[model samples]
Target: MADTLLTAELDETHTAPTFAELGVREEIVRALGEIGIERTFAIQELTLPLALAGEDLIGQARTGMGKTFGFGVPLLHRIATADTGTTPLDGTPRALIIVPTRELCIQVTQDLDNASKYLKNHQGQLRVLSIYGGRPYESQIAALRSGVDVVVGTPGRLMDLADQGHLILGKVGVLVLDEADEMLDLGFLPDIERILGMVPTQRQTMLFSATMPGPIITLARTFLSRPTHIRAEEPHDSAIHDRTEQFVYRAHALDKSELVARILQADTRGATMIFTRTKRTAQKVADDLAERGFSVGAVHGDLGQIAREKALTKFRKGGIDVLVATDVAARGIDIDDVTHVINYQCPEDEKTYVHRIGRTGRAGRAGVAITLIDWDELNRWAGIDKALGLGIAEPVETYSRSPHLYAELGIPEGVTGTVRKAKVERDEDAVVVERPARAPRKRNRRRTRAGEALDQTEINSTDGGAVATSSDSAAPVDNAGTDDADENGDKPARRRRRRRKPAGEGDAAADNSAAVNGAADDNAEVRVTADNGGHDAETADQPARRRRRRRKPAGENGAENGNGVAAEAAATTTAATASV
Candidate 1:
């Protein structure tokens, strides 16, 4: 019977049967029974037999189809048989399944676990585990220590754990890459290569993706050996596209969030999922909606696994009226009754656009997919429109107050824009004005001694010669005022005055005693010589030498006493003897 169904599926001879008539092994058939999935979809019917025969196969199908089970059942069956023959080293599994997201990891692991339930060998010999990011690694490490028969995880987390020696993949015989295109889209090809290198070189490899782009084709060629390509027709968007009316509105970047808030207030918005281009924008939109009295939740890569699960649960259970999310959540959401899908920001391309709106209008329900575009996103939207043949060269320019928006979404006219209301009117309550910030104060300090002296010198030198006084003027005045007559004013002849000593000439009396005595004896001769040039030259030379010696001590004794002639004479005599 299995051969008949397989041949009929390959040749189109007869219509395929229910999963019950597919002649799958009793264990798998019973596992599907528990999930209430009694029949096989066309893609599953075409690929399961080939996969179970250990033949390499390629499956082309849309998202949300049962492709996971098509390849999953055979992998689980192979794992159970391989486990019975040889105990894996340190409890490593014989099978490995790599997915693209944490949510898919959880979903696929649950499916594989269900499929492995009925297999024998009994008494706690088999184990299965799923690992992904946004969760602590303690539990995953503990699971690996105990051993898992099948490992399901995203490429990044799987490679991270494997590289850290927390996971072992040396004995894996069955390797499944699910949603291979998405993995490439997310730039995880290098990580995938590292993971594949760890598995046994010769193994049964199966690759499943929705649309096989050129890169995926190259990947399949490199990984599989003469694989049979099973091309399943893209699953018709039976319930989604048929029920959702798509619209694109061009607005300003700053006003996109306002448009979304208006859409949330629309009467038809049962529970809306607002898609954004980045995780930060998702959080911002969610927060804005919450501030407007709407119950909103958010989910993105930055959220912890528990928080992500909680937000998803709230969105599905009507606890949140609006859910702000990014493309990562777009593909993983499988809820049935989301009434509106709003693109708060334009998507990267049409593939993403389709996936974003695909969240709603599911299960034969009519819904709406509304796109709010900013001026900057127009070029991006054009590229997407051409790619999907949307033919919408320009989107309609819209504002928060557009009448058509109010008519279509059933929002009132006056309630479209954002505004913060005052708590009370000025007449009803007193208003307190806020003080402005104060400027920094400037500090004043006293000047140092050196700075004050520099200032005074600058003041004195500003007029040049007017402030230039000779430093020796005071000495000349004191010498000119000295007493030359006694109190009686008599004409008595003056005693001979001693001349001052020159520098290095210790005593005045010793240096000039002969000249003084000769002058007194030949007073007439001295007078006649002074009248001519003989004694005048001598007198001029003596004062010039005295000035040179006095210059050094003049500044040093600016405040010294002048009435100590007797003591000075004694000191001079003592200095003359000491020098000799």
Candidate 2:
């Protein structure tokens, strides 16, 4: 019936049913058996029957409770032509499974492939194509064109391909939404509804989630057509992991890495995972551990899809013993062999805490989970602790060197912090690229004077007579007509009164040159006459031209009278030259 909640669950005392016993097809059952998956988990045992009958049901189970196979097996079984006598395979998709994250899409695809290895149709083995973002569209488009019987992809990529008319959902008979609550948490509800609208309304729908909140329940009601709600949890089963041993320590933020390092070196430690609240912190912790000589890989939003997949692959294949991941990147990561889970930083809430620690203690394995709570994060962690009913409201104040930490995680006494720190130089995390330093710059300078270049000899030598060689016998400077004399033995400043033109071969230029020489001769003669005429101190200091100009007007002032003849002779010559 559509409105029924099947509360029947397989208790621990009761033996679980095998895939063959639950009427799974022989090919699928044999394929699963090859991988040592003979008996079904509680969720699979409950879901296989209803899912095989092509009924819409909501499967609920905690994380890592074999939920992928619970729906994957039935989806493959019903899609095979021999099992249900459905239409023969074509290139079109027959069953569509939508997951929330790229990692989960890959995980679900791998599981379906493992189970459907032997199950085939008239064409060949079932084609399960994985499509997700951060991948080229060409490859996925080509896969769809070649032929895929079942498609497992995230909501975004699936819608993109559907919109572009590459992935054909019209023929999809069975529809599944794996990790339904995670989809809601990631704000994929609208996209999920759109995907639901794209698929045929008469298709078999199954929704599986770890925790059912109001939104997920409402979603189930709106689209699931009163589907059967099958919860695979035991009666009175507490939400906490029964097999996982949790230890919460009030640790300083700065020293948490040291504490984690010690815990990682514990004797009982196997493959470990560390979770952080931010992408940056995940990469930091990963690098920190790597420098300590541990093979650590990091997965986060900042990493490219190739790098993320590489880290996950390496973690699963034993190539790396530790993986540091953020909440978003670590979603849908189902590794059963993770022996220890370390919360490198605080999680957001109880829901995140459950999903984070659930990464370990999976597939019925006992796991150890340790949480380091910072002083600032105590309030946040208290809320999570209260929500989960963990009695450790105030975490024990502990440090990396605390004896209790060594005792609990089984760290050997006196174990060094560095398990292999001597090799840090060659480790991948110790590299520091040195940037090249810039060269010094050379400056060009100029020393300038306004008009003419002053030579050293010109600055030192002047037209005045030189002093005697002996200091006591030095003659006094007898400068008569200096414009501005320097008592400090500096030369007087002098400037020419008239500008002279360039000399040419014309008789007029010759005449002008003769006139300039005659005036210089007149000034020199006047200086001599004035010096001899009981030299008037003020008049002698005056320029020789002023004296010559005054005495030239005095028709017969002694020197003027003498130089007047030479001036008259030059005047006659100049007049004759002009005529020529």
Candidate 3:
């Protein structure tokens, strides 16, 4: 039966056949009708019958073709038709759909959920859950514990849950692997094999891929049991190639951003996608375009799952006009209205190039795919061109300011890289805002000490400066000027100054002579001489001026001064000298 079905010629009629004619369950047909999908694609028409009959099959189709529903509709129908009444609703999943990416997983889950809406009325209520990384495991665990009829997820997270006993695959009635080629590219064949080993041997399995590589064939032989191969050959006049205009240009890396900015301003431009080989390049290009006044968003691996989803949602809703992304975003995104795809850098291979350009020229809409190849990447681009049979071996030389670029892309004359600000009122609730540049502030100059011309110079002894010495007479002047004086109006309070020296000295005679001479030279006597005018009077008495000496230590060889005044003056001079 499988060989006969594989050999059967697929119908390639102009009018598509209805889902009911293909033996899809009534409930699924009604659900698909509700979503406005009345007719089935070639892939769907070929695979639906084999899948609905519980036959193992392989589906081959391109990126934009209706591959999801080809397997999705059958998988949902099988679960709904099963008699799960006797089985406990212990959260064991009955069907599994493993995809390559989180985005694709969510996409497939949504599609399956929509198709299974009417399952409650036909067969008991069927629960569908999407489990992937970047989401909390508790919710998925809780959903599994309650009950789930179908589960769509990535390989790593599915294996993790299965290993932890949260996901029970023993009862899985049907298993589907979507994008098997992508999984192989991502090195998930081992994981896929492990997961296949966990499921019951007597179960229906379906595999779908855009391209059938050798590894995928080996994988199918190992797991699938006499699977029927179904290939949906695109029509000769496929709308994808007919609607999309392709251009290859050898551009300088330094001017690629400017060229892209101008191309974005083309009259025919709509929602555009820019692809780069690296996440950093994608983010840089997005930021550069945003700074140039284009409303742009970036999607890449560096962003969190929520942020990436938010950007994609905004792009779909027309909030952002341009989306810059890496090749990771090339596989799962399915936006229909994208009018332009700009390859900011050359893609690594032909398959990647096809996927990147496929973002545009979708759904029979006319689109443009522009590839900017750098000087060093010419060989890589040539390889892709030869592999895909693109006849253009030598791309045209172009620059950001080239006249041919403006003419070919339909850019207005004199248009530069910058976008002019719109005169219309801005949306107050807009999520992205263009802030005005801040003004520079003035700074004050510091004043120098020379400009102020201060009178006093701070003398520091540690820096080896001379210490100024003043006579003892200066003390009398300070006392006379003191604000706090004794009540008797005589003298203010004074502190005596004492000078001490170390015990060792040389030449005692010379020291004694120097001390006496220093004392007599500095001292001044106060005399008392008075006379009466007329009548005789006793001579006025004057207090005698006496000098007191300080006693010296027993081991000292220095001279002692007889006059206390001379000694204080000599000690002051000596102390000043020692300090200097």
Candidate 4:
């Protein structure tokens, strides 16, 4: 719990004094005056006196309330004062400012740099360096080796450099944790504790946040020593600025883009910011606005660090009139001229809604916030509305062409969704031609027989026939003769073939033939007479085979000689000789 609470009522009569009147250093006051930031915001005015006295405090305020400079100005002032015994003017980092995101780190670094521009030490000028991830580590290491007066960095990168012994936190006289609630939301509590342990406990510790959760308060109770809690507004009911006019409407999901396009054309509009729940939705809304001829840019988690920085830079410089972004990626984006904020998609809770709409209506300027809630998002929106005490529980059903919408937003009559002329490359009245279907390919097969290729004329077939033949074919049947004339003018003759029988009875016939024909044998290159009447001498040189038959087993012939087998063999041999 905070030991002391200071409620600074911020209302229409904001008669705050300038930084010079608050006893700020001449250099810082002059530097701020050059940037046209002379007057102190509520948070700054309340926090400056306590913070400059080297007292620990917690700053609780709405987003875009100039909280960065609240702790930043005091931090620079203490580090720049050479007479301070604890914080001597040296290159060693006398002050450390920790933020949650890289964008916030850069923003805080710029703010402190501007305030400390003319303040100096023996090393020449008061140096402020930004150390965040997504940039090369070598440069940051080199910068640390060279020494810096004040350091602004995120938790992860700060811990990395500290662990590597490249950063010196022992000499730090002041430690500030900016956006402490966002760090808790991002699960950086452990790293934050580690950083708190590293810095000197005797130094000044200041914690700032837009909202304080249970864990954040617990962290403060554990680390901060009797800190003072300062709230710019009264309580939960005053979360949003009084100058910001909020409108909620129940709209169809499909008509959201169309409705937003019309809202961009509303009168007295300047740069606008459209908030979405997802990176994809942010990109979609940005693209939709771009196609409608609106100068738009986008920043989300999906984009690289450089791209996000570039979009924010363009938005600040007036290069883009509209910016679409998701909740997490849009933190620390401060632009003074933002006039309108559209909720392309309903935020998750009251904090997100406040943060989104807080981008506009900054620096005590009047602004407008319009929310289009789909039917499914009504319950979620109701919870936010109830939490923030925004009594518009049942938003009116509206569309792109609703008369009330036009009147409420101050849209001119006869205005359409698109502002740019669409280009039509193809003629609308051109004839529609149909292309023909593709044809199938043909197949050609090459036929081969006996290691020789056969031409189409050499192969002739009859459908469902027992035999097929051609006049010039080398293929011939064993039992059939061809009537076609040959090149030598000879007629083909029929040749007969017989199969050989088993070995038992065929051995006798084979022996008898071998004995009778002498050297003439099976498949021998010997001349053979044709069984037909025709005699073709050229065919006689080819080999021919003579078939044989098998011999049967003799009955009881096994008892040869001593057992009647010899007598049966003798009788058979005599019968064969007589038959031959």
CA lDDT of each prediction against the hidden true structure:
0.68, 0.78, 0.75, 0.78
- TM-score, cand. 2 vs. native: 0.72
Error of 3 at 301 (Å): 1.2
Cα deviation in Å at residue 83, candidate 3? 7.3
lDDT of 4 by residue, 166-284 (tens): 99998888888888888988899999999999988788889999999999899989988889999987764478888899999999999998899999999989999999988898888
Per-candidate TM-scores read: 0.63, 0.72, 0.71, 0.71
Better of 1 and 4 by TM-score: 4
What's the residue-level lDDT of 467 in candidate 1?
A: 22
Error of 1 at 30 (Å): 4.0
Which parts of model 4 have CA positions greater than 4 angstroms off? 11-14, 83-87, 421-580
Tens digit of lDDT per residue, candidate 3, span 305-385? 899889988998999989999887887777778999999999998888887888887655788999999999989988998
Q: Please name the candidate that would achieve the greatest TM-score relative to the true structure.
A: 2
- lDDT per residue, candidate 2, 28-112, as tens digits? 9899988889998888888989888888899988888898999999888888843333466876789899999999899889989
Please estimate how well model 4 matches the true structure, expressed as its whole-model Cα lDDT: 0.78
Sort the predicted structures by lDDT, highest score first. 4, 2, 3, 1
Candidate number that wins on lDDT, 3 or 4: 4
Error of 2 at 269 (Å): 0.5
